[model samples]
Target chain A: MMLWSVVLIPAIAGIAAMLPPMRAVRRSLLVATAVAHCGLVGWVCFATPVVSRDSWFAIDAPARIILAITSVLFLAAALYCVGYLRREEGRTTCDAEEGFLFHNEPEGIFVGCLLLFLASMSFVCICQHFGLLWVAVEATTLASAPLISFHRHHRSLEATWKYLLICSVGIAMALLGIFFLASAGRGHAPGLTLSGLVSSAAAMDPVWLKAAFILLLVGYGTKMGLAPMHTWLPDAHSEAPSVVSALLSGALLNCAFLGLLRGHTVLAAAGLGSFSGELLVLLGVFSMVLAAVFMIRQTDYKRMLAYSSIEHMGILAVGAGLGGVAATGAMLHAMNHSAVKGMLFLAAGNLLAVYRSKNTCDVQGVLEKLPVTGCLWFAGFLAITGSPPFGLFVSELTILKGALDGSHWVVAALYLAALGTAFVAMARIFLPMAYRLPDGSPHDGASSPGAREPVWSVLPPLALALAALVLGVYVPAPLWDAMRQAASALGVL
Target chain B: MEVVSDILVVLLLLSNLYLLAASRITACIQTVALQAVVLGVIALTSAAGGLTLVVVSVTLATMAVKGLVLPWLLRRAIRGADVAREVEPFVGFTTSVLVGAGLLVISVVVAEPLCSSAPADVSAMMIPTSLFTILTGLFIVVTRRKALNQALGYLVLENGVYVFGSSLAIEEPFLVELGILLDVFVAVFVMGIIIFQINREFDHIDTDKLSVLKD
Candidate 1:
């Protein structure tokens, strides 16, 4: 019942959101549902994990971590949405490409889809059945597709088309992978339940299992924004509303990662840990290196942040692939990345709103313009780059230690190099935006120096950055235990 | 029953071929719809026992949505776009057909090991045929320029999944199967809506032109 409520509550609210004619009531509904969902997720994570009768839905350790991250990020995005929408209200924006004035997508549809997106993501975290999980993951894509094109501009429409088609096709591969999985366990294992697959893993056909694992990796990896399959991510992320981008990077990607991790767990249970682990490491390192190469001199800051998301996802994949303590590190990194990246995107939204352009060159002297957001953006940059005094630093250190312990010297070297390059690349962009004033710069926005930042937008990301800071210094005992359990569940330790 | 299933599988493979060769977008949609109807029939015959409630409902739903509803939607989209034939696909029809033949050989080779492990009742041709369909769908998606054709390719890919899934001996929960079907329906429905939007926004549904946001 607890697990079901966590998935269903937001779904009900999403449906209800479409009915109300007034924007304020709908906005309030979004926030209220987010808060309630967060509370339920917190209970499910901290209290004893709940498995539904017949075992279709369960909050396992990994699920707990993802659910917690998603719920918290949703709450923050919800708060930010209220202020963001208020500003966007009654404003007709001109399309950059076609030069036609257009109102944004209806607020009800936007808010409704936002809530449904949350419901689907939460459903991704809780579903124990691979088939149902696929359904839910696809639901996330369909629900969020509209949000990607909310501006109704040519660029955003193209982004939505690419996102819809690419992700739909990618996830279809996962459905085939699920079929392979069933074939592997045909007449031997009970069904597609996680626990069932694990217990009966030894009985499964190895050949079909191998095929299943590879296809599952490719399928979910695409959604997780791993390179080679990450073609649609930058366009989609950069094009969507920043708050939506935050959820996509922070929550939606993790849902896909959870799908991949579940597949990893099954392979490990079958004593095929090394097979999948090596493949994961290869993809992980490649994603990181690719993201690093792209992050350098990226003109669009939102796209830069999108590349950063791909890099962080790569780090998580690497840590999980390394196993033992590194897998724990991967779990921790997932949380840290969610908090930090979510904070960054929301902060980026502030910059976008103020500067009126995503181009880094177009916006200058953010510190002089909006002091609080500028500070948060800088802090977010440090945290995302895995610098000290932030949660990512601890998690990245833990992963590095894991790589070293496993004697994967090459992976360790490559990981460090990529991290370094990304940090430098992002620093070149973010520092100038925050601190430097370009020579003979035209004022981008009418706001004078030290403009008062909206409390709604500022507070949510501030809260997230503080959370990342707290985790950097100290991880609570329960969370540490959950991370360890999650690692072990994947046969890492 | 065996002959019937074999004929259905053959029809599916041929329709996949027709899809690749057909120049008209409407023709492609009709071919895919016919394949869906064929699959609906296959779903009925492929059930381990004689038809049950689950099998009947699945068959009816599959045919109704894939055969009747989806093609109608695609037709409406094409009408709105005011385009008919695929003027110049990235891969020419002759080349696509050749690739389709090559995919068939690959599918046969790839399905060998899985076929050996499959239960006696499972058709040897089913796995390979489904693989061919899946590859053909992907091929279409990759080689087609029109957004509508890509959408068709996606539908083909999904149909291939259904065929492969139905051939397996496992008993999936009814609700999950329904969810998969519903998801595909929504995916196509959503794609159609987007295609209309793309047509309106860009003045052409050619996806190649939709490349402004690239890095």
Candidate 2:
């Protein structure tokens, strides 16, 4: 009961946020629900793992970790949304005709869908049944579609279309994998359940299991944004609102990772863990190499961050692939990457507000022009490039060490070399963009029209950055214990 | 009775090939509709007395929704878009046909060993038809440029899975079936809405022109 309360409190708040009539009230409901959601997560942090099931739902340590991450991320984004809507309200001059696709209008539908998206992602993390998981994940795609297409421009439409189509095909393929898995379980009565299948995996046909695992990887890999299947990610992330981008990058990716982790667990229980681990490693390395090559030439700052996401997700997969201590490292890296990337993306949004473009070339005198946002963006750039002392830097080093200890020296070296290249590439463009003084002089800059600070916008990422730093340095004993328990359940450490 | 099942397998195989070789979008839709009707008939006829009859009823419904309603909807959408022929596909029709042939051969090779583990009542042809359907789905998804076509391709692929699973006498969880159907409905509906807006904004539905959105 206590475990379920952690998610349900926010879920109720989210639905309430959608029902309120006034825009201001809706925003408050969203923020208040977010606060309560975070509070629930705090409670779950101290609570015991509570399981409730009649052959269906289970609330174990693994699901609790997923619930905690989803709740926390959604809560933070929801708090940030209060400021986003405030900014939006100031800009939109209500006109009926140009609202849905073109206007900077505060749409009722957008607000509703956004909350629904949060609820759906939460549903995905907690659901134990494969059917429930699939439904929730696909529901996330549909609920979040409007958010991705918030601007309603031709380009946004294109992105939403691609995101929807590719992910659907991938998930549909996942269904086939599930079907084949069930087919392999001929003697068992009925359908799929994680625990039941694991208990009886020895008798299951190996060929079908192998086929199901491959389909599962490729199917869910589409959402995980693994290479060759990740064409939709950069587009959707770049085109969406920075807050939405934060959720997509920080939160949505984890839901997919959860699915993959579950698949890996099934394989491990079936004594086929080694084969799946090898495939994860190969895909992870391939993705990192691809990101490194592309990030060097990426002209759009937002898209660069998108590529960086690809890089970090690859690292998580690699850690999962290595198993043992590496799996623990992967678990930490997943949380760290989401927290750090969420901060970076939100900070980048603030930068976008000041510069009014995602292009690297156009903006000048950023630090002087919008000091709060500029500094945050600069710090974000350092943080995500795996700079020293930041949480990401710590997590990456941990993963590298784990990889080396696992006797995968080649992966460790590649990890270091790739991070170095990323730092150099990111710093090359970010520094000049931050420090270059506008030619018009500092006096005129102080008197420039429009709100220069983005103070509301800067705070969320700033708070997120601090959290990332603190976690990198010292994770609390309980969280660390929880992580270990989750990893053990995943069959790695 | 067994002969009808064998003939149904042949039709399913031929449909996969037709889908692969299809340059005219309408023909592809019609072929898929026919495949759906056959699938529905197969579902009704072959109820291998297993765990529950609910699953069989669901399969029959899936045949109706996936095979019938979906193709009809796609056909109407193609008419609305005026994209009757997806000519000059990314992969030409002939090469796709050859690839489909190769997939069929591989599927046969793969299904032989698989049949040993399959239910005794399950026809051997189920594997090849499913394989062909899966390959054909992948082919249409990759080769076609329009978003709507890819959505249809997704349905064809799923239908193949339904046909594949029926032979195993495995009972699909009801919630999963309902969820999958709802997912398909929303997915196709969303795709249709997106394409209409794309057409409205850009005046054409060629996905290549959307490349202006790069980093």
Candidate 3:
């Protein structure tokens, strides 16, 4: 029942938000839905996950961890949305502009689509049937398309198109992969449920199973922003509104990763774990290398963050590919990255709101102009780059240790090199923005008008950053256990 | 049923060539629709036994969505955008046709192993034909500049998968297949909306001009 509510509440609220109502009422509905959904997620997380009788959907250990992260991220973003939307309302007035069609859609659509995004993501996490999971992931893409285009700029529209087209094509391949898996299991298994497939995996046809795994990797990898297929990630992430970008990076990408993990689990059960793991490692390394090269001279800070997401996604892939303790590290890193990256994007939003540009060169003296956001931005940069005293650092260290333990010396070396390069590249852009004075002759450090951020916006990101910090210094035993259990659920143990 | 299957497969492959060689966007859309109709027919004939209600309904749904609904939507999008009918492909027509031919041969070679493993009920040419269609679809997406053409490519790609899926004899739930069709429909609809917005923004729907964001 709680499991059902976890998926249903946001869906119901999404529809309700679309109805003609007071703007305040709609925004309140978003907040209420987030809070209620978070509560249900919490309930489901603490209890033993109850699978439906058919096992088409269930809250497993790995899913519970992801669900908890998504709910918390959604809650934080939802709180920020109240302030963000209110600010946006004061800024834009018209519906259409000369060059752009529907340049300004109603705020109701954004609110409604965001809630639907949450519902679809929830479905992705809980769905155990391969077909249903594919449906849920694809639904997330559709639900978030409007959110990506909310700005109605040409660039955002282009981003939305690329996002929809590339992801649909990629996900279509995933559907093909599912069909292959079904074909593989035709004589062996009763259905395409994960449990059923896993139980009978050993008897499945190896050729079709291998084909399915390859196609599934490529398909879900495209969604997860793996290297060659990651062209859409930077564009969509950078073009979207910051909150939407945060959700895209912190929550949506993880859902796609979960889909890949599902395929990996089946491969593992079928005694083909090594093949899939090597492929993951190869893709992981490629993505990290690609991100490292791009981050070196990135001009747009938002794009930089987007590339950073690709980098972190690479780390998650490498860790999951390494298996055992590294898999646990990947799970921990996923949660930690969400909190930290979400905080960073929200902080970036504050900066964008004040500076009115995403270019690193255009914005300067953030520390003097918006001191709180500036500090958070710098801290977020540190956290994302895996600086010490942050959860990412801890998780990354665990992954490195696991790699060493597994004698994957080459992967460990490449991992360290990529991390070092990313850290330097990020610091070069971020440090100057936070501390340096604005370009051109400034009379003094006179704080610019509207430099102060609202407390509502500040608090959510601050809380998230602090959570990342605390998780670094000390992970609660239960969360640690959950990570372990989730890892084991992937056949990592 | 066997003769029907063979005729439909031949028609589907010919449509793939037509889609490749055709220069006009409307012609391409028509070719895709014709292919979808052929796929619908193939879906009916390729069932292991006489068509059950499940197979009948699935076939109808496929025809409605792939054959009628999607083509109609694409036509509406094209008319609304008021774009040129010429495809303006990145690759020349002759080259693409040759490439499509090459893909057909490759798919046949690739399907050889699978053909040996397939049950007796599965058609000999179904997997190769589907693979060839998928490759052709991907080829169109890569070589075409128009957003609408890319969408047409996506639909073609989906038709290939539908062919492969329908050829399977597993007693899968009808709703799942229906859900897949519905998803493809919605995807194309959303793409149509985005294409309209693209036209409004840029005064054209050529994706080559969408170069604002590059690393």
Question: How far does residue A398 in candidate 1 sit from its true spot (Å)?
Answer: 0.3
Stretches of model 2 off by over 4 angstroms after superposition: A1-24, A41-45, A51-55, A89-106, A188-191, A439-451, B21-23, B46-53, B67-69, B72-80, B83-88
Q: Is candidate 2 or candidate 3 better by DockQ?
A: 3
Q: State the lDDT of candidate 3 residue by residue for A280-370, as single tens digits.
A: 9889988998899899999999999999999999999999988999999999999999999999999989988877788898788887788
lDDT of 1 by residue, A306-413 (tens): 999999999999999999999999999999999999999999999888777889997778887888998998999899999989999999999999999989999999
Model 1 over residues B171-209: C-alpha lDDT tens digits? 578879889888999999989988988888777889888
| DockQ leader | 1
TM-score of each: 0.97, 0.91, 0.97
TM-score-better candidate, 2 vs 3: 3
Candidate that scores best on TM-score: 1
Query: Which residue pairs collide, candidate 3?
Result: none
How well does candidate 3 reproduce the true complex, by DockQ? Answer: 0.71
Worst 10 contiguous positions by lDDT, candidate 1 chain B: B79-88
State the lDDT of candidate 2 residue by residue for A1-493, as single tens digits: 6546655665565566566455567776777766776676667656776544325556556666766777677777877777777766644333222334265424566676777777777777766777667787888888788788776676677888889888988987887788778877668524477776777777787778888889888888889888878888999998888899999998888888888887788788788888888888888887887887788987888888888888888888888888877777777888888888888788777777656778778776677767776777787787788786777777777778888887887888777777777888888778878887656666566565434665567777778888888887788988788877877877756
TM-score of chain A of each: 0.97, 0.92, 0.96
lDDT of each: 0.90, 0.75, 0.88
